[model samples]
Target: MTKLQAEVRSNSVAKGKDAMVTEDELDNLAYLKAVVKETLRLHMPAPLLVPHLSMADCDIEGYTIPSGTRTIINAWALARDPSYWENAEEFMPERFMDGGSAAAIDYKGSDFLLLPFGTGRRICPGITFAISTIEIMLANLVYLFNWELPVELAEKGIDMTESFGVTVHRAEKLLLVPIVPQD
Candidate 1:
């Protein structure tokens, strides 16, 4: 949280303390972007990407997949695959930073390991808008105030469980107390 606050506060000096994060400044907020990527990696909006149909008979590994077979891509599993990610289950935003191991991987679909927004010709059309919205909202939140974890969670810890549906949701509600940061 301090890292995010520092990143936002450092960039917001010229914009004024009251000014919300702007779209133009998103490019310079590297850590903010990494946080968003890490968030998506841990809790994806959709666990399974849109299903695909095989165009022709093909063999993957040892199994033969016939044409017209409906195949679902488990994007959540791919993002959390240990072989492709170090400490795969851990929430480490730095993994997507400039020199991090997964730096080259992204949700834009170019990288298969981290395809939170799906990939190929059928990739999400709202991807650009979605990422920008996430970046701006997250940047502003960290820039505007300080957040405190609930007292109950401090002792019990946060519940990372999820309830599956059209979109994934936290099984337990997280109540964060936002304290306006002082000058």
Candidate 2:
């Protein structure tokens, strides 16, 4: 979050402005978009996406899939697959930025590698709503405040363990303090 804070701060200064980030400004924040993409890649809200039922018998990868078969797309594994991603397990947001192999792909389901919001005819209807909400909220959070890990957490580092369920969430509650920005 410190890195994201710095990015937003730098963007604010580079634009020669110090005010709440507007929707138009958010649209042009390339790095912010990359950050959000990396986040979705790492932590897909729905790991197995909506279960898809095969309407007719078909062959995929030499495997015969019968009609009415229930198929679950493991989006989480797809995003983190070593074949598709470099430093797969690391949280380097730049992988989705310029000069990166996966930079062109997005979560719109068209790119099979990253499908946070499923794709195709059955894609999530709230995609635009979800992405915009997240970007605006995050941009404001990182831009308007200085966040710091609690003293003990700062010393010990944060635990990234996740608890799997209908949707993934941190196993342990993240305890961080958000300080009002001095600037």
Candidate 3:
């Protein structure tokens, strides 16, 4: 296990909770989970899901569809729809705080609002492992490092431009300085 995993486990154990995650604990870690969910939402590794051919004719919205029609769901637009989220352009993780909203909904069922790993039986097989790894890594990084913008960059403010290709990356790479903690 990673250091962050150990720390989270230790903290939970110290509080008399089980070492492994419980449903209630998952519920309580809403904010942390929201951050991960939002990141996945905004930066979906695959912007579009694999095309699916309809088995039969269907009507979606006001549009009528024919049988065997190839359909591709745009994960990117769904993540940033203003109808579902306030300040959809901003990276506010707290948008998911309400249990009734898309941010708070569980991923196990037919969750169409946010499908970073896709949905249904065709969803990525590594979803569980990926989520756990990211959570542990983020927890460890935040716990261990004090990140700061450099003097020059801080003066000018950080640039938020993105470069899109096979995968998205910052047009300018993150240059924050990490200050190691004194033990």
Candidate 4:
């Protein structure tokens, strides 16, 4: 967490004091982008993408798919597959950074192994907007404030148990104390 804070702060300093963090600055936030990518990989906004119908007969890894079959793509499983990710279950953003094992992967749908957004012609139209919004919001949060676990949670650590739904969320709501960083 401290490392992530450092990354955001380091980039934020270049904007000078009192300048609003904007989308234009996102390009400089490589680590933040990697963190967002890793988060999407681990906890996809929609774990089960909308069902895609097979337009024609197709063979995938020897399995014959008859035309018109509704196929559900499990994005969560794809991200956890050891074949595609190193330390797949761990929350490590470095994997998406340059020179990391899965550096080339992206949520843009071209990469089958990390499709946070569904692929091909049916890919989500809001993908670019969503990614940009998240990155900017996250960058601002890290740049403007220092966050810490609530005192009650400091000793016990975070409970990451997730509750399944249309989308997944932590079973226990996260509690944080955000203090504006003093210069």
- Point to the candidate with the largest lDDT: 1
Off by over 4 Å in 2: 13-18
Model 1, residue pairs in steric clash: none
lDDT of 1 at 91: 88
Worst 10 residues of 3 by lDDT: 13-22
Q: What does candidate 1's lDDT look like per residue over 1-183, in tens digits?
A: 999999988877465656887888889999999999999998998989778999999999999999999999998999899998899999899999989988888767888888888898889999889999889888988888899888867777778789988689999888888999778
lDDT of 2 by residue, 66-156 (tens): 9999999899999999987899988888888788777788767788988898888899999888888888889988888788898878988
lDDT of 4 by residue, 1-183 (tens): 678778777766455667667788789888999999999998887888888889999999999999999999998998899876788899999999999998998777888898888899989899889999999998888887788899989999889888997678889988889987777
Expressed as tens digits, the lDDT of each residue in 59-145 for candidate 3 is: 889898999898888878887889877777887666666843565455453667777777877888888788877776665554556
Give the clashing pairs for model 2. none
- Predicted candidate 4: what Cα RMSD to the true structure? 1.7
Off by over 4 Å in 4: 13-19
**By TM-score: ranked, best first:** 1, 4, 2, 3
- lDDT values for all models: 0.88, 0.83, 0.67, 0.86
Native RMSD of candidate 2 (Å): 2.3
Candidate 4 structure lDDT: 0.86
Screening candidate 3 with a backbone cut-off below 3 angstroms (N, C-alpha, C), the clashing residue pairs are none
Off by over 4 Å in 3: 1-28, 98-100
Which parts of model 1 have CA positions greater than 4 angstroms off? 14-17
Report the Cα lDDT for residue 64, model 2: 100
